[model samples]
Target chain A: MGETPPRSANAGTGGIRVAPGHGQPAGASARVAEAPVSTRTPGGGDLGGGGGLPRARAFGAERAFRGLTLAAGTAVLVIIAAIAVFLIAKAVPALRANTANFWTYEGWSPNDTAPEFGIGTLAFGTVLSSALALLIAVPVALGIALYLSHYAPRRLGTALGFLIDLLAAVPSVVFGLWGRDIFVNPVRDFSVWLNTYFGWIPIFGGDGPFGKSIMLGSLVLAIMVLPIITSLSREVFLQTPTANEEAALALGATRWEMIRTAVLPYGRPGIIAAVMLGLGRALGETIALAMTLGITFGISFNLIENGGNTIAANIANAFGEANDTGRGALIASGLVLFTITLIVNITARAIIYRRREFTESAA
Target chain B: MAKRVDASNVTAYYGAFKAIENINLTVEPKTVTALIGPSGCGKSTFLRSINRMHEVLPGARVEGDLTIDGQNIYDRDVDVTAVRRMIGMVFQRPNPFPTMSIYENVVAGLRLNGVRKKSILDEAAENSLRSANLWDEVKGRLGKPGAGLSGGQQQRLCIARTIAVEPQVVLMDEPCSALDPISTLAIEDLMFQLKDKFTIIIVTHNMQQAARVSDRTAFFSIEKTGDPGRLIEYDNTQKIFSNPSHKKTEDYITGRFG
Candidate 1:
């Protein structure tokens, strides 16, 4: 990105000489040399030697600031590497000790003599619940973000944005308790209504009690993740350049049309990153899902049935009554969750980076 | 295709602040009129009010009357979008929708007007690019993003996008300010050709640009810092530069004070 400006400057100079029938190539070359001087001044030693004492002091401060920021950035990578190494070391022993097929086994009985357990149902439930939660949350979040960014009045938008930001600060345990107590009944009624109308569909075909089902757990997770997605998306939408928006409007676009053309296209990668962040949050939310979902061992797609379990919830629920093997098994499940989150984050970053050239050029 | 623009006692405000007051001007069809003023003198604001683009900002609005070809644009029953369709704008900084392809950017206005036929879009894109003098440069790379182009090319792409809809009037707010001298020259040359089809109103900080491109010129100035900007003089470009009626206009034209 830094190299582009100098290259373009050189190109501009070359184009000028060729097009204008000018014979002074030396002057053009000198102009090109001058273009990059300001960019190079910070690192140049001549400024400090020839200039006043204050110039040397400012250069020292700049070097110290750069060094401090570089150290802080490297520290983050070191900490992340340390965590990954620790999780893998704990997870390896448990996998080797397992008697049954760790990949396909349907149940967890790691405390048994031959200690058998697998992540099949737990991983499935984790992915399904989180994916469902994101499916429910993202569209609604985008709607609210657009409303706040474009349609709502300024004061109302700011107030609503602040309230949504406050929602993100609420503890997960509070959400869990609220979901368990207050939100469960309404979700169960909705699930029953869905089942009555759409029972032929496998996911809604279940007839048993529906209060502590995947539907309920996912609804709770969706609500928990909603604020993060909405806030991030709102920020992205608001950051759509005024010039671009005016360009759309001047081209005869209505307000919504302006947003469709200028704001949404600009915010696509950002909104994707925001949704992936929400998915990550939903995937690892232990207490909320544990409290809302029925902690069953079997895998089923019947969302209205009281039978679902996730990896994080399993760890939280099973950690209390576990022996050494059970504890190891729980850590192994955690490692899988970490891996899933890592993949989610990496994919999101890749999507954003793919459009970096366009976005950076605009800036 | 061009339509005359008439502004009568037009005043603009941003919240409680009066930006421009009691400005009156008439822009003839198929003619290029330049609004030349110092920075902060509200030339851009007055230019924006002609197409009702100023009101897009919160608490920014215009009063009195602005009309196109005898139809009052700011009437209570007027559709703002339709008004904008008849009048397009090119901003100071080139702003082609960064995510769109060059082809998409050229057809963006047409898409808004619901012209979805591929053949029609292809024809319009080629014509508009040719009009903006950018077709040969960008014809092979139409699928590439608009932001991938050089700054001058991006500005021309914006011009192509604006002209693709065939607006009757084109408003440019300091279009050449962000461009290099060569690119500025290219745009100035384009303006001369464009005036044969569209009424052009350009707000420029460069006196030479006004002298070079505009058929008529309006000079704007403020008496003091907090005072609203007023139109000091309006006349033929040659007359304004050589023999202005107002002392302020002469002072400004001679670079004595802005």
Candidate 2:
């Protein structure tokens, strides 16, 4: 505390981000790093440098914590990156041999010796069915969320919420099995009824899968993802500020009105995130659609008639028997699916981030 | 007097536990009535009963007649929504709807009641804002979300929202406790002006505040002898503070006991 130190020791020890000589620590910013780590008594003969042990222990503890976090986070990132890399390496030859037209031209011949593979049909089926699934899931999911958060009594809400979360945690294979045996069989009549009554719409207008079509696949996918979307949306709706809710009710608004003004407003970002989570689930849905969709590799716009295959469903159905180019092309499809999911997840996060900022500034 | 709220022999309970017993009060139109008491004296609880706001709590039941202008609010034929529509309320903390803009926050009641006319909404919103004395500060930022406003502004915004519905009576529960001195003064002024247009019933811990703002004050005390809470005094502001009819009231105002 008595002696003055040299400039370099002062600057470096001060923990300034820049190394410009003679520059001091920001007046209020006061670098606590420079403060001695010792709690030595004032007259304890220069404290015997006791600061070293605790400083080292604290540093070690902090470094260990940060190291563990960074390692865990990076491991996850690297694993995903590795998977993408593997998919790209496997698919590059197929993509190089074919052009963007590979995505547009409708032909599947990965099994043949000189077979040309095109994802045109698969891409169309995937996008169309996913879009349809979103259309079906968003409104129902939001409705369930609203009911769970605002309409239901406390005990009932807790029970129903638990059930929804349990449904979400059920294995995808089990959902597929359920779809094949129970849900699809029962709902087949409804699909046929739709085709009969309102088949004028191109989606429902088809030659009839006898209840096995792209529409059926979309529906199965939608049902499978319903709990996921609903659960996430419910949490977001529940997180709506209590004051915000009461404000609406005190204004003579109905329960539904309070939800519209407060619950939905606070939950917009979460709802978008919920839909994306459902979309991710839909993109990867394979066994359920395969069992129910009557999978065939053909391009058709009529959703009620012929079965359409998603990227995941196509891979599952054909990956075992596929040959060299066929395997490569299938892996290529996997790559495209991976890219699409990444785009969806990243976009969802970006939306949530922007929404947080928007609400923060507004608040 | 154009009485806005009349509660006769009104008693409320939660399950087997009686919360407030034998409350008789009349709130006149264009006048302020204060409910002052120590904690758990049913001051806030009684205030909420007037607007049926306390009914939102589960297992809360009322055992006496409550009316606005002689219309029984709890009658089987009465619509709860219509009853609440006539009596607006502000809470302990400023509770502006977080997601809505200030404009939307004020006009939410009108919108929900199917008032789709934007011009009418605009005019009402402006009038309410002016009545709450928040118009000049928040006028240009009606499109901005309400939660962004400061605590005092948010409280004022809530008052504005209450005014927008044009209710017959406005019930406030510790409306200025969360505010600063300046904010509290602003609200006191707002309340003074608001009494000209609507009946006001306020629950406050500040006896000085009660003395300043209220024309009539109901002094309440909790009796430890029974499990249920009892209302010890109900009188004019002057009598309650200057020459209270009850010992508990004297003890409370003279700083002898809570």
Candidate 3:
């Protein structure tokens, strides 16, 4: 079997010689001789060739599976790189054509001859609105999450969890329409009430016409982001180890005390990640803000006044009638938004990574 | 300070399934009592019921009287947290809080009891660690995460945490099953020392372990599968091992049958 010359000769003549010897006990020997010859020829062998053919086929399949998964992983990176390159290529010409400093100027008029525009006010509005939204949403979301994970009966918790997931699936345009129509009157009255009693504070000190303002936009954004944060944090809280909870109880902790000691500490990183994800959604939200905000073009800390704008809402509002420079400017603003989201995600990842040593060893 | 444990006509259940039936035992203060049994025999269940820890699971409950120093723990008006505080438990698996430092782990019980002064916390942490026989190995690394320790050290840290509040009783549920031989020996030695200050009740599958460490041994077994476990024999460890009165106890100790 080890001689190459004899094997080659046998491969050519063995099939023909084995075909006529089926009548005697020598038939078994003849079939074995033909089997090795046929199996050695790769794809030409039948599955009846047994061990070697199936094993070789399985090896080929394993290699093909690995290659497919590798390609899938690389596709995501390729798409991200392509987007960044295209955004930069389109943004450079718009920046070069502008007569005003892109970072400091407060007005936006990219359709004019000089195309003087800047993102200073837009960036400010975007950050302030999202931060305010987070302030309103985070506490409520954590309360709901804790109730769902630890306090509610199992059936009710499951039902409430499903309802929260459904909330996340609602269209943003519907939220915009609802905020502009039904929610605006109550918010206007509340703003008037605030300005009456506590107008000394900068954010609450607006003069008049408090119906469409930054506060309204932030409230709408908070409503939109609440379900996402609640669901994700609930998942994290539910994953607290039973052993750790038992340890706390055996140490004489009350129910709330057990949660404070065991559940909250274990869910810290997850809560941070969930909050950052909600912040990302709030920052990039457009239709809801466009409908709810006054869409002014200046930097002001008055949250209850009728004037605010963000990078994404500006892009959506201006992109309809924009010329070449205007479109490029909008794309440039999109690139800035993209960069902000990227920074937020990377910071969240760094926070998680810094604590991996503790979490992993415990696992 | 140690407290005597008295159980009369105690039975436990998980929803509709009876786990242990009609157990009666008295454990003297400052003595080690070992509960030996086969798998699914409800020895651990009985031990958890002593501290009212069994009811933490949904639908799990116990019936009859379990008393500590003549006060019934199962009385309708008794506070469960106070019961657990007076009777501490160490689990089979060593579960030190993964998020806390070694010093924080030791002081966790005290913190739960609302001890806020830093000097008091520091003193309790040191004393508990020393009593658990872990201070010498961990004194230099009090700031390190509790999970960074070896398995045996983590178990000892859990012991220290349990004792920090000065509980009158301590329960161990196969505390050395997940440990190596050397760690097992160290825990056994610590148990001998701990018997001076706290009432200790332990559940074990290892017969030799029960014989070696316990003052009194209770043998638990079941009639058949799906039946509740019963106390087959209760005697001094020497009498139970050397000359058992019941045939089933003799058979289990000699390794003839579970």
Candidate 4:
């Protein structure tokens, strides 16, 4: 090839200067000066001053930050594993010492010389109460969430949303006290009314003693978890994309139709997650359920009868007076509660993953 | 079915702030009309007003008359949903319902209108997709999520969804602004094919697109920021591009000023 003029000089002469203050000063100018040598030589490291630029650090603060986050994430799994190990280690010895069958026996007398205790009553009551609570709470929570996100004016929605969040911040112990001291009155009268008119229904068949029953405990549980589901569902509903909502509106959808088409579908997975979280809270709830549920030993479907018990509530009520074997028995029950919650969470994740295509695409 | 659109002395506002004022334009049936303007010039606001979608936003409202085929759409007794059904809109971004399948997105309007027969929905889905020039690419994937499509395909899917209900008028607001050049050409071609069945109104920032696809062009501009936008010139595309009467229109078309 014939001798070629320098490329930067030729390029500088060809184009108009668009950016003001165009030329580089000092070291940057020197770097630009060596560009043509590298191109012309077509060899590595041919340009002068090319190696003068400082190499980036072999390790940076980002590595430390990443390690910190990784450790934080792993710490959660480690703690969970530790809890499982402790529960199992504590529980096996008690199960061996127990005179009664752990799963099927209804009575709990673990402190006795021939300790006879089982999770049958506690398991039945826990499932029945939490399920009933969700049945009552989910619809009401969804209704409140939709009202807050869609029907309320901007200022009203924000105010109401703040109030709902504050509702969530109230301690569960306060709910327990209110359920026992104050709220039980109306529930007793309502239970009497139910027993009077609807006594034919098995659940309401019980007479006279109606206060502090499964009905009361479930009602208290519903109120306790209501704010959790409502706030989370409202947030999810509010996050429905404006583009999706507008697309529905522009397609001739009525207000309800718009919500059904866009808001509800887009918020489905999030709402499911919210409901599952609420269910988890209701399942593991201790003090409030302990105070409200009448502590009885048998499994019964009579909701208005003064009889119900749950694993967490039993644990709380019996923990103070428990012996070593008694404590181990309680730990075993706690293990059962832990397993139930794990199964519930895993089921929720499976449901979410089943619709992974839609959720992922939406994200 | 095609319908003529008439807007007279229309003013739209966001709360107290007017976005567009005194927008007077006539769009003939079975023709393509383009609204061209700079950003913040209320071209989108005017297009949204045609279908009452402008007022969907909080504190937004519209005043004055908008008629489709000589019937005022904003009358007190008129159902808003009916007005929207008659005048369908395709948004700037392609928004196929994220949770819906391709077939469901196309038939979403029909389902809203209470059409429930399986055979009817299937036929309508196919026809609408074909009209939007997307049937061949998507027929096999009707069960797939509508959001899984490419950007260009999604826009086309949105077009199909809009037209499936067979609105008399279709409003497009910068439909090709988010697409690549090849995709833009596909949409422009689709717009041409669509003009035979529906009255089309499009808002665009691309001057050449307006010149190429529209029979008539309307130029909108604002005096300054925070001021309401006004119509500068409304004329035949050829005349407006070649010899605009207004100085502002000429300057805008010739790249002198926006």
By descending lDDT, how would the candidates be arranged?
Answer: 4, 3, 1, 2
Please give the CA lDDT of all the candidate structures: 0.91, 0.79, 0.91, 0.92
**Which numbered prediction scores highest in DockQ against the true structure?**
1
Worst 10 residues of 3 chain A by lDDT: A51-60
Worst 10 residues of 1 chain B by lDDT: B143-152
Per-chain TM-score of chain A in candidate 4 equals 0.84
State interface RMSD in Å for all models: 1.8, 5.8, 6.9, 6.1
Clashes in model 1: which pairs?
Answer: none
Tens digits of per-residue lDDT for model 4 on B230-252? 99999999999999999999989
Q: By how many angstroms RMSD does model 3 differ from the true structure?
A: 8.4
Candidate 2's residue-wise lDDT over A221-243, tens digit each?
88878998999999988888777
| Colliding residue pairs in candidate 2 | A363-B148
Q: Of the native A-B interface contacts, what share survives in model 2?
A: 0.55
Q: Model 1: per-residue lDDT, tens digit, B1-258?
A: 999999999999999999999999999999999999888999999999988999988899999999899999999999999999999999999999998999999999999999999999999999999999999999999988899888899999999999999999999999999999999999999999999999999999999999999999999999899899999999999999999999999998898996
Per-residue lDDT for A1-363 in model 3, tens only? Answer: 147568988987987555433332244345446766432244323334542322222333446878999999999999999988998999999999999999999989999999999999999999999999999999999999999999999999999999999999999999999999999999999999999999999888968889799999999999999999999999999999999999999988999999999998889888999999999999999999989999999999998989999999999899998999999999999988888889889999999888886776566
Question: DockQ for each of the predicted structures, in order?
Answer: 0.50, 0.36, 0.47, 0.47
Q: Model 3 chain B — which ten-residue stretch has the worst lDDT? A: B143-152
Models 1 onward score TM values of 0.87, 0.88, 0.90, 0.89
Highest TM-score model number: 3
**In lDDT terms, which candidate is top?**
4
TM-score of 1: 0.87
